[model samples]
Target chain A: MTGPRYTPLVAALPATVPFIGPETQERARGRPFAARLGANENVFGPSPRAIEAMAQAAREVWMYGDPENHDLRHALAAHHGVGADNVVVGEGIDGLLGYLVRMLIAPGDAVATSEGAYPTFNFHVAGFGGVLHKVPYKGDHEDPDALITRAAETGAKLIYLANPDNPMGSWHDAATIARMIKAVPEGALLVLDEAYVDLAPAGTAPAITPEDPRVIRMRTFSKGYGMAGARVGYAIGSAPLIEGFNKIRNHFGMSRIAQAGALAALADQAWLAEVQTRVAEARDRIAAIVRANGLAPLPSATNFVTIDCGGDGAFARRVLAELIARDIFVRMPFVAPHDRCIRVSAGRAEDLAAFEAALPAALDAARRSAG
Target chain B: MTGPRYTPLVAALPATVPFIGPETQERARGRPFAARLGANENVFGPSPRAIEAMAQAAREVWMYGDPENHDLRHALAAHHGVGADNVVVGEGIDGLLGYLVRMLIAPGDAVATSEGAYPTFNFHVAGFGGVLHKVPYKGDHEDPDALITRAAETGAKLIYLANPDNPMGSWHDAATIARMIKAVPEGALLVLDEAYVDLAPAGTAPAITPEDPRVIRMRTFSKGYGMAGARVGYAIGSAPLIEGFNKIRNHFGMSRIAQAGALAALADQAWLAEVQTRVAEARDRIAAIVRANGLAPLPSATNFVTIDCGGDGAFARRVLAELIARDIFVRMPFVAPHDRCIRVSAGRAEDLAAFEAALPAALDAARRSAG
Candidate 1:
């Protein structure tokens, strides 16, 4: 009873994850999923070179990773044509987002994001006691303009926009996003998440210089690079904004093997291009599967395809449950309207085939249950 | 441009490190260090089995780690003879410390720690806007009584005590630490950091129940397990206290390879025992080297020895500089009194041989420079 006491904010927060991981769900169900298309992880797997690098570095795990993340940052900077000072690497986009929110948000401060955007960002905003004003998605795509307008009205300090976005696989081209950044309003900073930029067509990411103080672009190794388990992500921005992460980040949080793996991943552009090709093929195949099921597939610039369930939220929920019951792991958005769609990630041919084979049965079961 | 704003406390804080990493210094020096004994990493390395497990898991890095860290927690709980609920695994002790501080310390709240102790803990407290109160070391050891008294005076919400402590490898027996834990002021929680305990002699850690609500004990594989680069650490406390971390922890931050590595490391008790034996031998060797050079080596229970240069902080610093100049990477405490001792970690036979050959020349060079 004599332990240190927690602050009111932390004490008030509940221990929760916005989404239950498939691993946890599998344990509960006593069976692993036949097809894991949820979480948007690259089931095509990382490049052989990245796997080799990680394996080689495994023996060197006794030495802490470079706190500066020097080599990886330099490689990333060179890849993006920026100075090393313009970058800071972290655990993942989720982890970087948490640090960004910590640096910029205080208790009861306002933050703006799409209502059905990445939930992890919202989790962090709430973790720091920030008051969030959520703008709903417009036409299945994140409405950057509405987000900026709300941020302006609320004097919000942070705005999140994921280009080639998640859950919906929608995108606004670079020029449009750059203009949105210009309209973010004074005192508010934009967090332009480009987690899926590698999967998007050229020009999807804005051409803003890394020195731009108005926005911090978040990129990750989890998707296109196929290293989600390595947990490497970085933020590119002005020197001050990037350096600001040092204020509260876990300085030695990164795994040495992960840094090596990510460095290898960044160096292997040919492999990245190949993965992009595979992801595109997978995206098309996913869309084909949705069409074969008589559902409308949204146009996707990212690695996933969002399929309209041709019904309401309830129907989508039933389809998702049926898919889970059929051992095909897939997910849907949390909010209304968007919840009418099921999101499936790009995966290996084998994994997608499992999904392809299981869908009709899952839909049939859902229909039977609905009846 | 404007964005969601930072809280006042976050805005007021400066980004800083308790210690500059050797890699950072290397970047400045434009070369890698010949010996990396500065960061208290176990150059002895992790178990072969651990290396193999990590390597095996490398290709599977495409999948996110189990967010619950269930398997690792279960293994840790079994290792400690406690229930699985009593343990929470994290990125490292550094990661757990940040979460604990965030949970307990808020703006203007008081927290106490030994002066010149682990600086990362202090960094986290400051990051959360907590007011810090320092208790000077007594006879180069963390004085638990003084810490308790300061906690009572400051009405501190948290107190940090590192046993088999860092910077200076001094420790109080379990009975003493248990007594101190009992005497902590009401509402002040004691954090018992036993990061070095596994390398210490028997009876170094307190005999506390895992379900004890008054204290939380943290351990790491970074030291004795020789996997610092793997970034795995755990905390043992009441279920409720352990659960509090989930409210804000990076759920998927752990590397899949790391989990496997740690699990393998934990299972290989014989490797740990062998390493402990080696560490003890190295400790004695370091002490003898110090004595041969006419310096004083403090008795140490941890993997490193702290040697007093028999002069002021400047003289000790000069010795450190000379060592680095000779390609021997060693470190020292950052504050007065404690800064009089240069700390050297246990290294391999060849590394120790290099340290042995460099010691006299470095000392002589340091003397010349001082003159």
Candidate 2:
């Protein structure tokens, strides 16, 4: 028998995994990595209170989670000093991105983002048959002016900008971001993704007003709160815009454990401060390790540090392979210039210790392989 | 300035909630539900092993869930005697329905289901601009023949049928389902939603093969497995069709705790059997309670029973209202003919006792209001 009739758009799309997960690599290697510093997971883990909350929630999973996400919304609103109407929650940033793309981008609609930004965002755009107009990173950071220019030129209805960007761990200052917000073309909605802002320095985030029509910002518990496995993310915007999510979102999609865990994590600011300190220390240690190997570590406001290998893209690829062979799990940027650097997450003491011991031999092997 | 520019279809679609959760109702009444039987949740709860697994997974929340869903897929495959490629896991049946509709039904494409079938399915159809053709239920059962006929007539690309159906608590046996599958119009795929099948009789489900290309059947942990808040649902279909989900789904949407819990729940068949026995006893009790109030109890293969109130839709609605006012959460169908009933789930002993105590007054109040 023939199969179901897939829509033309879906049929044309390839089954691509946006990110090759570390578990997949582990399976391929037939064993687990000694250093799990890839995927950018917080090695510090979630707050003890958050874990306790999730355990309590696990006992009550016989009932469905509130479809309205009411408790979490009110809690998040109170946390942000905005009305509950300004917030909407989803499975994670990935899930929210899909819903946002579906609501705003009809087939062939124009969307804009950096060429080497989050691949998950690009995956969503292509899934909805949206036309993507991308600007390359200026040096290692996302070029805000170029994105605004591309949006204006191509009439892109949605412009995606990740402050304290991923892959390169670079960010624009608050004033630069404010300028970018003003420069957004009239019809385009800027998606200010602040998934990492909780770990960034003060003033890294611009002040947001719920009624400000220019942008909808997203934040997640995945990076800073260290609950990536919990899969909680939320968007803040005008009431009407937030309410529009009701038209297309999967109601009752959130896991009850996730909601309870995120609420507890958000409440424990002291644990977050401890994580920030740990991440900073790890980042410093990572940079020193890179320097000892004669590689340059890029400036980072994010938890991960991107180290530039003293060679071309192929040399960086060899270095990455050598690292993987040495049981170190790390990733590099996908495109050129940026591809010359490999990214590493802030791991705990033993995990980082493994990385430090592996780097020298991995680098020497990469150099010999290139020669 | 205007907020984000929504696509014309989304702009036209009203912001609607398909189901009004009991939590929402409780908040409105500023109280808790004494007897919650509306949502058909498995009040008997999940396996103790599942709870322990979730608690353990909670401590590992620093890492993201395996995006590939490899371990869970293999487990489900082994349980079903199918290859891992035949199963695709999702947030829930609701989330899977959304993705299925997106993959198969392009804008303005035709789809078919019962007129009073699941509203969430209809919501997904409307969200994607699929034109839904509906046929009324025949003798309180979803008419599979009529659904197939309508699909053929309207060139519907997808036909939805829920065995052991919701609201009506009715089901078609295996042979009837097989005949319906053979009758599915060429180029149209049949959607067999067996969300409640685990609680049905021995011969209720048709035997399925991984190579079956004519239909995709969905199952969930929400009803019989007693883990509604886990948000785990899966579809068994041809490998190619199942793979198509990778194109649009939130790859990492499944929560880590949920994955671990569902895997544990699936392994403990004894727990599921115990829940089934408990549900059957509760259903019988519910039926007896309804008969005591002079209402007719419909025969059910599902986890809930629908009681005919011996009056019209409006009368049944009044009865439902009185029940809710008494802090007993019950629901009635929305459309006529079928709407003469109020549906209740098989709650535990205390919850059912609360239901038994509250019904007589609710019936009297409804009659008094009608008089």
lDDT of 2 at A61: 97
Instruction: Give i-RMS (Å) per prediction.
Output: 1.6, 0.8
- The lDDT, on a scale of 0 to 1, for candidate 1 is 0.90
lDDT of 1 by residue, B148-236 (tens): 99999999988999998899999999999999988878888889999999999999997758877878899999999999998999999
Query: Which regions of candidate 2 fall more than 4 Å away from where they truly are?
Result: none
Which stretches in model 1 have alpha-carbon errors above 4 Å?
B1-6
Scored by TM against the true chain B, the candidates give: 0.98, 0.99
Which candidate leads in TM-score? 2
Worst ten-residue run, lDDT, model 2 chain A? A206-215
TM-score of chain A for the candidates in order shown: 0.98, 0.99
lDDT of 1 at A206: 84
User: What lDDT does each candidate get?
Assistant: 0.90, 0.93
Point out the worst 10-residue segment of candidate 1 chain A by lDDT.
A1-10
> After best superposition, candidate 2 residue B57: deviation in angstroms?
0.2
Per-residue error for B201 in candidate 1, Å, reads: 0.4
